[model samples]
Target: MTSQYKSPRPLLGAALYASILDSLKAWLKSDGLAWLFAFKAALAAILAVGISMRLELPQPKTAMVTVFIVMRPQTGLVLARGFYRLCGTMVGVTVAMTLIAQFGQYSDVFIALTAIWIAICTAGAARNRNSRSYGFVLAGYTAALVGVPALQDPNAAFMIASTRVAELTLGIVCAGVVSALVFPLHASDEIETTLRAQSSSFFSYIAKTLPSRKAVEDVVAMHEHLITSLVNFESLRVVAVLETHGMRSRSQRMKRLTSELMAASTRFHILLHFRNQLRLSGDHQTLDTVNRCVGAIGRLLARSPDVLDTYASATGTAQRLDRLRLRVQRHLAYVAKQDGFTPVSSLNLATASDLINRFGTELSAYVHTYASLQDERHSRENWLEALTPKTDPFVALAAGARAAAATLTLGFFWIATAWPSGSTALAQGAAICALASTATNPFRLAIQIAGGTLIGGVVGTILVFGVYPHLDGFPLLALAIAVATMPGAFIMTRPKVAGFGIGYCVFMPALAGPDNPQSYLPEAFMNDAVALVIAMVVAAAAQALVMPATSLWFRHRITARLKAEIATAYGAPLRGLRAEFENGVRDLMAQQLMLPRHEGLPIRIPMAWLNSVLEIGTAIIDFREAAADITSRAGLSHLGPAQAAIRAVLPLFKKNTGELRSVAIDALRDSMLAARLAADDATLLPSERSRYRDLLTALNRIKHALRDPQNALGQTGQPSVAAPSSR
Candidate 1:
């Protein structure tokens, strides 16, 4: 009877355990990030509050609030933000002390200096694009917080600054630890997924484009998708740098891979752009050579398994492609000597051959870097590490101006009111202006934050007075804090209400002002709450009223810049031509965020316009690089006419009509013929002839691109769609 009872109990327990484990697995698959993020955030908040209380800091809530601010879904992002926050806080506190010390006797002078400093920091924050921007935002707002508090008790400024910094540091440390120790979501994991997706998309694009030309419309669509993939890769790589040790070690190689991928894509497009020209020449030999080469590359691309598993597998495929490249070069050399060859036909064939070879080389480099990622020991030598582009000066100036205007408006309001809560309002407005300045919709975000603040205040009040009073021990208090913070943390994990969540977490602890004794003053709560709401409203209003960067205006600026860059491209030096061309167009594509596809408006530039700019710019840069090289080598004697013709045609690209461009193309063609005849001199070296031939091809392609802007732009007479417009 005892054996029978024990057996049944074990069986029943096993069944129950199996069911619970299954349910947990399903839950983790669906809602892991949200759950883990919330848990980590709550845990961090609890830790921060406990540490602050144990240390006997004046503002325990400040430390708790910081945990909420710095916490992110991924370890890399959290660490990055935390690092920047510490730096920004230090800089801000130092600035506040300096200003206070210098202008102690003159309140007006101190206030004025603080406002100016806030504006500058706000400007810097608004201008940058990544987590680095957070430093500037913190610097600006921390100054206001530090300076405004000290106005009441000037002698205690040092103590106030030191305490604030310590509290923030504790908070950052707690958030980082909790996030890392919990179900840690690493950015490197996301990066691997991105790399696989990117590689897959690239292969798909290559398969579709090679061997033959697709419709211009289809090709254009592929290019847009490719550009998006590349941009995503870049963003993921940036975060991946800080994600894991492995990622950090491979970061430079990944960058080089990105550059190679871009160069390869550019070359592939060039081949497609001129493929038709080569076929239309009706030279069966040249056409066959081109077809054979594409087929060879396509077959080699097919040999690789879809997934990049290991270095050995990728190397085998790369070796096969290398052999195919040699065969294609031989075929091109053989075909160039045929009797039916015209200068245009020969140049087209040669350039297409060169591009195919280049595409293979770059692809192999990218594949090697990608496959080697499984193990760092397999990592190879770097070839092309692209330089990061500088931010556009005009964009920086616009952002800075807007930030300054908003900050000054709030600063002036505080000075005029002289209200007791005026400092709170001033500091809040300046902080919001600095942080949210780069947001897509600054006013909307600010308003949401205000709503969050009100909600958080209520929650914080309940926890501090009602819940905490019932909890006597550290464990109970920690539990109480976690319970209070859970709702905000849950909301923070949601994408739509994230801004509201930020406001809630930041304002709750701040308004609650948890301390050892826990001061319960309803008047202070009401005053601060009103001041916070007023500050947000004023900040939102300032952003709305001050030279706001509406989508419509931004699109207009991008359109102008695209036009302006062609002129710049024409005159720019050749050393970094390819990088500048690629970087500039990609930057423009990034700015043209969300253009409606079906909407057609004559006044606005369509997404196609930017796409056209990319293609056209690529062709133009190719022409310029080839022209510059030929001129340098041949001493501008044989290639002078062609070089001059290129210069003459450059200005025609700026024209609205195609008539002048048509004339320019004729002039360019005549110059190409002259250069080709000179290139045929038997005394000239084979390398010189090769350079001349390449230059001819570049010129010829540009002429064709100019002749039919519609074809070049991949537009089929559709009216342009509206670009970014006011929502």
Candidate 2:
């Protein structure tokens, strides 16, 4: 009894140790990566400063600031950012030299010309996406860095430009090297891991959504998440291509896989739309049939956690999907012969069958492309089409005008006041405007930037006045700088505070102005710091007040663009039509989601518009395909009413008028009648029969989608027409 009782304390002690160890492991897995990234960033900043000081550059802080600006957790991002920064710097330097040479004698003219250049670069930044946007940002800011200082001393413009370029190059090189060599995190590995996770989650999503009665809002949220993941994946892929030869070789396959995923997702969405329509119509028999078929496919898509872990397993999944596709076609024929199906229900069943078959085909292709990543001898496939993002020209132009206005306003202030730190203010404001132009909510980002700069200024002042005076050597200087910056670097890893971190790390060294023989002029430091803060405040105001993207009018404009995607489906070339249409509409939706929500605008309006666009656009594409097949095999003469029906709806896509909607619905009813008559003709060849039947299905889907009371088109008064009976 004594021995048994004595062992309980030891057991409890061991259990407690185990629990603590587990907690530590969990923290390491989550926050540990961020800590590692922070350490690497600090190391890069130190190396850049050390190199710049050793080279006896005029200001080592510029180099240090550049390191923080470009250093990322992954090697590929660092390299890609550094490469673009160098390019932008070169372009900016060239432009600055030209502007200074031409207008340096006239300060007003020089300032105006610099503002124009900044405007152009800002527009480019807003127009583009991903790292390419960073290039435009740098181009806009570098001009200010070079031209503002050179305006006071034109003779030294070349020297100023050269030094800036050299410092930036040194910083870029250091960041790239450190990121690649020191505890490297390759983008390829991240991509692979992301692919596995996304694939698994997507499979689960399909399994859950297919046969269930999930709300439309839930589906929309998931769709938004998937679209975001797709965009992020593309960004990672671009950087991965720059990081390793293996990734470069596999780039086409990766692109192909993305395209396949997009296509497959679209098909699944259409399938869901049909099932939803069936359920809404209260056609329990047809809905049950569709559910059973969909549930079977979902079960097959249901994958084990490690299903995508190996190429062989993925290949097996692909084979199963291929077999399922054939089975679906046979099942479609069986469903069509069932006696209880009404005309509308039959049409719904056929469309659902077609969608499931197409989805399976696309899913199989996606799996095959994924598996091809591990195969060295995989043949080159046709290049997958790139997503054509629909950026509003007005939005881009407004961003440009805002940046230019901010720069010109600041420039005038500098000239009017003739403050010693005016040049610094102008440069800092221009950089702030240009860098924040592409942000979803530039005003919020500007506020974060201002806060970060304030903190950075305080830290820099203390370090320069209090800490640096006691420091003796470059190593200690490096140590002090690293210690000061590491927290900001760590903050950078958390997206919520990333803007603050960026502002802190970048502006801290800049405010300190650490040089070879560092000058600690408390007065000048205070002046520069105050100027920088005021400039950021002005930039923030401009972002919020000057054609703010968050405005109701801007949201309306984006909504208009989202609706216009149906026009793409109607008129765009058939080649890559589906991908282009889907990406364009989804991209606009993504942009809309990025804008801060307003009380006046219900999110449901845009969500409804998105659903309507996808439903109608997809039907139009299928209608076109079926028409093309029927036209080639038979003739377009019989399909005239269907074609007319599609044309009638195009105008309604822009502005859903009751009159236009009624006309479209009438045309659709007539077209359905004509298509049924054509299909019933015994003279029709067996080969041509299926195409005509497909045309009817597409028309039926379009008509039903338009009639749905939940979408943008439905808000219009109902059509004053009657449907033909199945009997």
Candidate 3:
């Protein structure tokens, strides 16, 4: 009664305050990191520019530009990038000085050498990924920045080089320190969280998709997420290794964990493929058996502890999963023989059973790796081996060729015209080629960057002439810098338009060329702006003219490469081959995802082809693993005829001829019959007989899979489905 009579004003105010605080916290939880990153970036730029002004360095904006370029969310990323930037800057300076010394008087020769160096660096950038690629990019552009500016005054080359290095170093230091000390994020933290989330999401995906007839879009989306997670994890591991000594020590475990995840995912895909194949063959019994194994695995994962939870729970879950895996394997073996006759269906069941068994085995290994990451015991053992990254030589060569052609064209144009702004064209062309090499959609990226550059140039020009005349001292300069950069920093937060910020950052400082006594002439601004725009235009045209990438030809090239990888998979060695194969196909999948949508091009067809390749390749790897011990114990001669037959058939699958594929299928079936006859040999040991039987079963399943004309191995021609297109 007394409480009811009390005034509600204080209570209402407190409740309102609590609600506001909660809402604000939620918003911060969602968007806080982005805002914090932007704030730190802007602040670093302001401080760098202000310090450069105080020190009276030439082009204080150079330091500001570095701040924008070096800004990353994680402290480790910032430090890693800064280290590479420092290294790249020194190398570029040396290159520029050497080039200037060799061809000081011949501008054309100097420009060509500079262009070639840029092309080489761009090629390196294309071959690399993540922050590693950033180093190559910086190396390319820094050479242009150092060399082009000093072309008019050769004597000032050292001074220009030294000043640029100093400015960039200052900016790097500022960005690294600010990013670390202010609300610092760690790559390790991100990786740990992702590892858990990915683990959970993967199991959840398997569980959810298994019981239902999921749409193709949903399946594609699910697989896309898994592939991206795998790729992202690999990149994060590299960055995490450089973050701290502890992380470096754990790098091997981390690498092992990634490998296990990939292997597990590969097995999962095998299981899914077998299930799909069974359905395609209209084998209801085998499909039912596949579903049962998948269901059992899902149930086990469903009951497991949160992978990101406390160490005790994770270890317990991992232990339980290990025990469950043995049970699952035994169950699969029992089911494999439950059905009689129907060689095709029985073979499908056997393959599915083997896939499930391997999946559980790999899943257990993955769980162990996960548990190892949470281990407190740090060992001195060096296990930091990494898988060799897969690269396409043709892709790298094409990129280099395009860059070289672009740079040479621009160099020739500059020489032919004898324009005063030739240096601008050379510098921008090299920089653009270097930067654009990494872009998935270069055509679209070029347009966005160009548009953003023009906008940024205009804005920067207005700010320099219209506002700076009335201002003085470091404070006013800092304010102006903030005003110019904050909007871009904010724009960088948006994923769709983040590239706009890059263009803005690059052009703003170039157009303004912020110096001790700022140039305020409209004519100077307009001339620089016009030169910058023209340079971008030349670069874009060069890119278009030299190996244009958006045509059907490029799509076909990607498709052909993907098909070739299947043949490569068939012949790969077992040791370290699985990881490499998975990574390669995933890389191709990523490239496939990047293809721009066109009217005639349906991504689904390539996607379906990709899925088929992955299935066939994965099955081949499984066959190798399964056959290795058996072939050795049972003697190669016992399996020789079958192996030779399968080998002969494999080449036929690589071609687009349906008749050849049919012949290959027939050959495989005959080989399977031979294998089954050998499996019944009375001289064979029981264990050998079992292995032979399993081998024969897998071969039969592969033969049955090949019977479907549409599932031909490495075949390019596929019936296209005209679904709503997606990228």
The TM-score leader among the candidates is: 2
What residue runs in model 1 are displaced by over 4 Å at the alpha carbon?
1-30, 104-108, 211-213, 276-296, 299-307, 332-344, 374-386, 389-391, 464-466, 567-571, 594-613, 619-635, 711-727
* Candidate 3 residue lDDT tens string, 1-727: 8866998889999999999999999978657767777788888988788788788897888888898888877788888889888888888888999988989899888888887888788878777766767788788788888988777789999999999998999999999888888888788888777887888887777666665443223555666777777777877878777777777767887777777777787677656655666677788877776676677667666665364365556677667767766776777677665756387676666666677777778887777667776554445123444654533445555566677776677677767887667677677767767767777666566677788788898888678778788886768877777778777877777778877887787667767747766777677567667777877887777667666556565666666676666666678678877777776777777766665665565776566566666666776666667567674444455776666555655554345466766676777767777677777887776666777677775676566556543353534465432211111
Count of steric clashes across candidates, in order: 0, 0, 0
**lDDT (C-alpha) at residue 571 in model 3:** 80
- The list of candidate 2 runs beyond 4 A from truth reads 1-17, 213-217, 303-306, 388-390, 631-634, 716-727
Q: Give the TM-score of candidate 1.
A: 0.87
In angstroms, the error of model 3 at 181 is 2.1
Model 3, residue pairs in steric clash: none
Lowest lDDT sum, 10 consecutive residues, model 2, at 718-727
Greater lDDT among 1 and 2 belongs to 2
Query: Which stretches of candidate 3 lie above 4 Å from their native place?
Result: 5-15, 211-219, 280-282, 303-311, 332-348, 376-385, 388-391, 409-413, 416-418, 598-601, 630-634, 708-727
lDDT of each: 0.69, 0.82, 0.72
Task: Give the clashing pairs for model 2.
Answer: none
lDDT of 1 by residue, 472-527 (tens): 78898877777777777778888677778878878777777477667777777677
How much is the lDDT of residue 464 in candidate 2?
Answer: 90
Best lDDT among the predictions, by candidate number: 2
